[model samples]
Target: MTGSRKSADALGEAETIALRVLGFIASTEDLFDVFVNASGVSADHVPTLAEDPEFLAAVLDFLLMDDRWVIDFAKAEGIAPEVVMQARAGLPGGDLPNWT
Candidate 1:
């Protein structure tokens, strides 16, 4: 689905929030636990979040701006440079009914 540039911009913000949240975790297990404890989201949401370009870029921006997490997310999440481009060209959030 297509959205106006403004809507895309908002999604970018949400993606940043999501990524910032992800960046806070200490490990993969912490990541899994975060999703497990999320109000209505699941672990599968990670890939969905990753596929959101606007969001991913915002997320990456968050990471880049935060010296603490910049290298950690890249290292722990196995986020490669090539995948970073795909992340920057992402779409939006997922189609899951219970998005949170």
Candidate 2:
């Protein structure tokens, strides 16, 4: 699904996606734990990292690692399932699978 030009043109879709992803993590303990563990960001510093787009992309990337999480987040957030990939691509590295 195409995102609104207004949202995309404003602060950027990455920001919206990041915030929503963070919200998703906030609502789920296990997901938050996994993000904290995998991201290696101290629990106390998560708020700071949450302000970082790269880090937010990492959050989305983490979700991208699992189809279930992607689907779940989509359903829960009421966003298009395609938003995940768009958000993933909005990150620093885009959404290409790592072969290295």
Q: Which candidate number has the best TM-score?
A: 2
Q: Best lDDT goes to which candidate?
A: 2
Task: In angstroms, give how far residue 94 of model 2 lies from its true place.
Answer: 1.2
Task: Write down the TM-score of every candidate.
Answer: 0.31, 0.80
Tens digit of lDDT per residue, candidate 1, span 1-100?
4578866775565555456445555244554464446434455675575665654554544444444454565565565533333343343433324222
- Candidate 1, residue 2: the lDDT equals 50
- Summing lDDT over every window of 10 consecutive residues in candidate 2, give the lowest-scoring window: 1-10
Off by over 4 Å in 2: 1-11, 95-100
Compared with the true structure, the alpha-carbon lDDT of candidate 2 equals 0.80
In candidate 1, which residue pairs get closer than 3 Å at backbone N, Cα or C atoms, i.e. clash? 53-90, 53-91
Against the correct fold, how does model 1 do in TM-score?
Answer: 0.31
Residue 61 of model 2 has an lDDT of 81
Query: Cα RMSD to native, each candidate?
Result: 10.2, 4.2
Flag clash pairs in model 2.
none
